[model samples]
Target: MLILSLGRAGDMNRNMLMALVAIAPLCGCQTSNQADYMQIGYGPSFDVAHAQCEMQKGSVDQGYIAIGSPGFVAGAGIGNALGNLAAEDQYMKNCLILSGWKRAPHGQGAAAASAVAAGTPPTPYGIQRAPGSWINTALLDWSDANNKCVAGDKAACGTRAKLGARLRAAGVNPAPV
Candidate 1:
C-alpha cells in the first residue's frame, strides 16, 4: 500500500484564506434603496398590494438560481444574482405604483433595525415588511401636504390640517411637518 500525506496544513489554510479574500466582494453585495411604503385602500392594504405585485412576477430567488448557475461557470454568480434581484425589485416597484402604493416619506432605518432584531428576513431588494409597524395612509398624505405647505402652497396647509386630524383620530401624532 502506498500512503501519501500532504505536508504543511498551514499552507492549505493560508490558501483558503486568500481565496475567501478574493471572493469577498461577491458575497452579499446586493445594493438596495430601503424605504417605507404606504397605500390607502379600504379593501387592500399595503400588504395586500405587495402580495399582488409579487404574484405578477416570478420569484426573485428563482431567477437567482437560474442565472447564477451559468454565472458561476463564468465566475460572476454573485453579480448575476444582484442584477436579477435588482430587476425584480424594479418590477415590484412599478407594480406597486400601478396598484396605488406610494413610497412613504419616513425613513426606513428604524423599521429595518426593528425587523432585523425580530429575526425577519434581511432586506435584499424586495418587498420586506417592517415588524410591529402599521402603515398609516394619512401619515403619507400629511407628509406630502407638509412638503407642499412648506413650499409656499397655501392650499396644502389646509390639506395638511385635514390629514393631520385623521391621524390624530387614530391616536397617531403627526410630527411637526
Candidate 2:
C-alpha cells in the first residue's frame, strides 16, 4: 500500500523538465541550416538540394557516431564533436541557395487575392506547374522509394506506385520507379 503526494508528482515533473532543458544542447540535434527555418521563394531544384543536404548530413552524423564511441578518441574535443555533428548545415544552405532559393517578399504571390477581388482566377506562380500537384507528390514518392529500395523498404515502393497511379489519373504519366 503506497500513496504518492501531488506535490511529489509535481516536483518529479519539474525535475524532468529541468533535465530535458539541460540536455537539449547535448542531444543528437539534427544539423540544419538557418535557411531551413526560413520560407524562401520557389526553387525548381529545391528537392535535389534538400536531398543532397540530408544525405550528406546523415552520412556525417553516422560516421561521427561510428568513429566516436564512448571509448573512442577520434572526436574527443567539444568543438570537434559539435563540428562533426553540424558539418553540413552551411553546406546545405548554400546548396539550397545555389539551387535557386531566394528571399521572397512578405506578400509573395498576392496575385491570388487580387484576382479574387477582381473576380478572376489567379494564374499559377511563375515556374510552378498548373494543376500538377499530383506530379509533385508522385515525384517525391518515387524519389523516396528509390532511395529506400536498396534498404529493403518495400512499403515506400508501394506508396510510389500508388502516387504514380494518381499522377496518371491526373493526366501526367509518371515513369516507373
Candidate 3:
C-alpha cells in the first residue's frame, strides 16, 4: 500500500509539472510581439520610418514634425549604428519633412494662399523668396482651407478676408485691398 501511494504521488507530481510547462506561456510569462520588436530595436526604427514616410507622402502635417522629429533622429541613429544607408535616408527624409522641409505639391496651395494673404509679394514663377517659404505658405493655406471646408466653410471666402491684410503687406499683386 505504501509503495502504491508513493507511485501515485509521483505520477501526480509529473502531471503537475507538465501542466505548469503547458501554462507557462499563457501566464503572462511570454514576450509580446511588440516587446520582441523592442528587444531587437526594430520598433523605434519602424515607427520613425513610418512617420517619415507619411510626412514625405504629405499625409501628415508639418506641425506634427516636431512630435516625430525625435523618432526620426532615433531611427537614423539606429540605422547608422546598423550600417544601413537606406534606412538612414528614409529616417532623414522624415526628419526633414518634420523640420519644415517642403517636398512637393502637398504643401503648395497653402503657400500660395499665405503669400497672397501675407502680401509678402508674389514671386514670379522663376523667382525665389527664402528657401522653404513657398512650400510653407502652400502647406499653411492648404491646411487652413481644408479646416474651413471641413467646418462647413468650403467657400474659404472668410479666410480670404482675414488674410487679405497680410497679403497686401507682402505686396501680393491683384489684391482686393
Off by over 4 Å in 2: 1-28, 31-48, 58-77, 102-177
Candidate 3 residue spans exceeding 4 A from truth: 1-81, 84-139, 146-155, 174-177
- Best lDDT among the predictions, by candidate number: 1
In candidate 1, which residue ranges exceed 4 Å CA deviation? 1-35, 40-43, 59-74, 108-177
* Candidate closer to the true structure by lDDT (higher is better), 2 or 3: 2
Order the candidates by TM-score, highest first: 1, 2, 3
For candidate 2, the lDDT comes to: 0.50
The candidates, ranked best first by lDDT, are 1, 2, 3
Best by TM-score: 1
How far out, in Å, is residue 100 in model 2?
1.7
How do the residues 5-56 of candidate 3 rate in per-residue lDDT, one tens digit apiece? 2234565466446545654554453221211111111123334544555445
Model 2 lDDT per residue over 68-105, tens place: 23222222333344665556555665666665443334
- Model 2, position 137: C-alpha lDDT score: 46
TM-score for all predictions?
0.35, 0.29, 0.22
* Pairs that clash in candidate 2: none
